[model samples]
Target: MKIQVSTELLDGCVLALLAEKDYYGYAITQRIQQTIPISESTLYPVLRRLHKESWLETYDESFKGRNRRYYRLTKAGTKQLGVIRNDWESYKHNIDWLLKGDNHG
Candidate 1:
């Protein structure tokens, strides 16, 4: 069964992607889909929220006569990504321990 992803996790994922390089909204969605099952529709709001929160900055570039908005991580976003990654590691460790019924993760 596929488990539903949380908003925080989604935000982290987006931040991680942008940490590598800037991406347009559609490209971000496609890159994320390679590892997680997420829809384009679902990602826009995350981008909007990040942009609104000042965690992300955007610039529009022309591509094939159309302008595509590209997202890049800000200093705040980098800091947030570090926090999320730490939380994820802790959460994953605990969950793995519970699932395996062992002390090791």
Candidate 2:
């Protein structure tokens, strides 16, 4: 069964990818597709939100006679990534415990 992914998780994933290196929108979407099912329509809004939140910055670069907008994480974005990662870890641990029927509460 396919599980639904949350917007927070999607944002986290995007942030994580940007944490690795600057990438254009298409590249980011393609990388995300490798692990999760997401579309440009969904991703573009997230990118805009992140940019507005000052978590990401963008620049246009010429590549083969075309300008590509690349996104890079700011200091705030890095900090946010850490927060998201910690939350994900905690969430995963709880889910695993429940799924394994190891819940003591």
Candidate 3:
């Protein structure tokens, strides 16, 4: 079954990927696609938004004589990732509780 991913989650995923290391746009989309169903188009705007928000910084490197823009997480992005992770854990726990009808004490 297909599930919709929230924009906040998408941002988190991107930040988490960048947290590991810097990556170009295509590489970021490919890595995210391995776990989530998303198109390259869906990601570009996210990258742009993150860049505008100052959460991500980009640098261009020549790859095969072509400039590839790579994204690196900024301090703000790392802080945002932490917030997303905490929120996800809470959301997941609530969903699991509702689905399983089990107390997670």
Stretches of candidate 2 off by over 4 Å are: none
Among all windows of 10 consecutive residues in model 2, the one with the lowest summed lDDT is 1-10
Number of the predicted model whose lDDT against the real structure is largest = 3
Model 1 worst lDDT run, 10 consecutive residues = 96-105
Residue-level lDDT of model 1, residues 1-105, one tens digit each, is 798999999999999999999999999999999989999999999999999999999999999999999999999999999999999999999999898889754
Q: Candidate 1's error at 37, in angstroms?
A: 0.9
Clashing pairs in 3: none
Question: What stretches of model 1 exceed 4 Å from their correct place?
Answer: 103-105
User: What is the overall TM-score of model 1 with all chains considered together?
Assistant: 0.95
Candidate 2: clashing pairs of residues: none
What TM-score does each of the candidates earn? 0.95, 0.96, 0.95
**In model 2, what is the error at residue 8, expressed in angstroms?**
0.9
Q: Which stretches of candidate 3 lie over 4 Å from their true place?
A: 103-105
The per-residue C-alpha lDDT of model 3 at residue 90 equals 100
